[model samples]
Target: MKSLKLMALATLFSTGLHAQDRVKGFVYHDVNNNGRRDGKETGISKVAVSNGVQVTLTDEKGWYELPVGKDNGIFVIKPRGYKVPLNRDNLPKFYYLHKPQGSPATLEFKGVKPTGPLPESVDFALLPQQETDDYTALIFGDPQPYTARELEFFEKGIIREVAGIKGVAFGLSLGDLVGNDLNLHQPYIKAVKKIGLPWYNLIGNHDMNFDVKTDSLSDETYEANFGPANYAFNYGKVHYIILDDVLYPNPRSGKGYLGGFRKDQLDFVENDLKFVDKDKLVVLAFHIPLEHRNGDTFRSEDRQRLFDLLKDFPNTLSLSAHMHTQSQIFYGTAEGWRQEQPHHEYNAGTTSGDWYSGQLNEQGVPAATMRDGTPKGYAFIHFKGSQYVIDYKVAGKDKSYQIEVFHPKVVGHGKNTRAGIYANFFMGHQTNLVECRIDDGKWQKMTPVSAADPAYLAELHPWDTSEELLAGRRPTNATDSPHLWRTAIATDLPIGTHSIEVRAKDRYGRIHTQKSTYRIEKAKEL
Candidate 1:
């Protein structure tokens, strides 16, 4: 238990000292809720532990040994039916930082200080908790607040609606927890904790320490706030892996950052999966999308390596949020995926939509609708066994308000309409079945178009073309909305109010129906 001299593991390895070669650990049941193993406390068997890359399971006596080849982290993966201790920020403290020499000294944000020496017996304690296969997790993306005022706007605009929400097992924010201002980390945590659930966070590109010269030290502040930037945990039948995939000081550009993973991260995935069941749903959550419109933002080799690691796992899904837009991207054989079933990556919609722009609504919060016409909202991923379905919830709106139907409110009597009816199914994909019907008539298939959402354009127009200054900033110009569907309707129907109903079946086979009323009137009345 004595502290060894402060020395990097690499230096010691070169000098032929193998003090840090192996990590011996015990996974014990914390009967009294204490974090230490007592005389009567029993060790838990078959528990998985890891040294970042290599994974090992506890023996019958709850003992495990993982080889720590270099300066690597050692942590326990919380098994199902067991709960790890949580820190003050409600973050699960299931891992211990193993940087003997600590982080590099020059980084602006401080990382873990020198821990001196490896412990004789590194132990993990867990309390028992009952979990259900059918549970929902609250998912938020890019709650990136820049200032205290913007933080307040985030609280009032998004968090206000889901405060103290029930029926959710836990919550996850898909990175970009704060804007460039790292000081807002605590404030962001304070606001999100109001939901009263265990929360996990992914380190975003904006969350990195830009002052750091290399990508390895980029996450010092993030790691200081949240535990390990990359770690894994289990709940019910699912194994959730949270990774820090942002590589700062872009290797190609030598500035800013790139979206990808390090070799150790891929190795961690390979090692961790060794102990996981093939049938269990493996979920990976991170910040940058694997593929961006500008092309593949992440390195192709890293993605291929990840896909290779996930080849055996039949049920897997990755969640990302950086584009500030909501869309579903599937990677198949063309993307180097080995399995016949393509990997599904959900590029989540941001809570801070369009950098929190647009005019303020009656609630005094910015409209902040994303450029794609998707509202500033969060999502709920419902999981049952190894299968899952996602539902996006627009802040301050009812759950049933899933589709935004755009059409003219009125049309001239007996005249053919030039404008077509557009439906922006916020959680839709091209493969989804989108159809529209008029006044109980037969449904007509809607065409998928890669065009801007007219509704979002209309939302931005009032501010863009304003004669006077508006209360809030103008929203960004509309971009191609991937989820938009359109179908033309004839205004030749008799003069009266008509209902246009839109029906969509998502990839998961969940059907959603929404209707809007449009009127036909005489020319004189118009």
Candidate 2:
């Protein structure tokens, strides 16, 4: 009889714990100098309450429920306008930041330093949601500044417009805060902080401090000041994922300047995917693009593994930077796996707007995209719950960007006969396409040539205004470097003269076109 009673008592205790499996918290807007949510203070209604994933509006009384893991469910999303208090590391004190911070010497992820009174009631104050016909997260590609003057170029060009975002909820940078100088992050962050919205930062190839040992280069301070380095947050209806694409301690260079991810972060991504609804959109963002440099640069082994994890999900948007121009393409069947197009990618342009090139606009901004004739801008994405649309918004320019086009330079009638077709878009990134058309026929795509190829890399314009480089961001030493642009040779050619025109288009429907005329005289008898 005693043993039975003990067993029964244990069962009841287990059930009780299960009953409280979730962490319970109440949200209140900070109103009238009071931290508590009072009765009808004209606040809290329509306020969004999220456990960091599924979001629900607060009831008339600011009542909300957050489902958290039995053990780690202490975090609540900090409402906009009112920010959570910062801890010693400047991290928000509330909203469940898992780890704790002991000392600056310690790693940043011991989890957040717990919370204050009102354990169950975590209130948030919002500045009233700003509604627009659309919303966007402007992505800047590699704004790799070789010097402080280049930083000025960044500010004078791209920063001016980004600093003045009107209806933007937030902006996300795809890494490369500096050109191999980790020291620049502080000033870079300060400059970008002027944007006024909650901007998320990512680590890039150039941002690494090579002097530090690989283990110590974990970017602890980055997470300390910028929150979780590998974290997912909900904004509007979309789930934004900012990943550390550049794995440090790279083997190729014996340094951390290249690309790839650590297994730990990849695993984190796997776990994060489980938190959201497959039907909803998943935006995968990183610095190195999946398809770059003649389709070689990407986090494939890991990316494919991740691609498999996300393939089952209904909709996904993958965004990247690193390459300093604009290029975009689709991938996968949106269902089963195809070996060919496993994933889609959109490489963003530099926010320094052509590395601060060209003359200044009226707003005191420089001509960032002066070379390709493209304007400095970030992407504009709009989401209605789950469904969404992406557009290109060139900063300072009144018009939204659409894809431009050029016809392939083909010598003959068949495949592989393509002579040459190069795209010269500057600071152009986003969901766009560099499609081509032959003799005004069906539009075809011109594959992005490599900036690594001696011929092409030489032509690729660097935004950094180094005095040594000549026209088009290339070095004036090209004539002697042996890497200067090489003459292109097309294998197949017909016996007649031909003319071709090509066109380019982005998701925003922006367009650019190019045409060339060539003659192929009858070949002499061999």
Among the numbered candidates, top TM-score falls to 1
| Model 1, span 1-526: residue lDDT tens | 1234444444345422345577788899999986788989889999988876667889998999976643566788999999998777677778876667877787766767876677898999999998989899999999999889889999998888888899998999999999988888888988988878889898999898898777767887776677678889999999999899999888888887888988767867887888899999999999998874344478878887888889899999999998898999999998888999999999999999888898787668888999999999899999999999999988878899889999999988777656989999999998789999999999999999999999999998888678988886778889999999999876788889999999999888888989999988986543
Estimate candidate 2's alpha-carbon lDDT, on a 0 to 1 scale: 0.53
Instruction: Residues 265-304, candidate 2: write the lDDT tens digits.
Output: 6655665666566766678888887653332455456655
Model 2 residue 16 CA deviation (Å) reads 30
Q: Where does candidate 1 stray beyond 4 Å?
A: 1-21, 69-71, 292-296, 524-526
Off by over 4 Å in 2: 1-134, 209-217, 251-254, 292-299, 333-342, 353-377, 384-388, 393-526
Clashes of each: 0, 38
RMSD of 1: 4.5
| Top-lDDT candidate index | 1
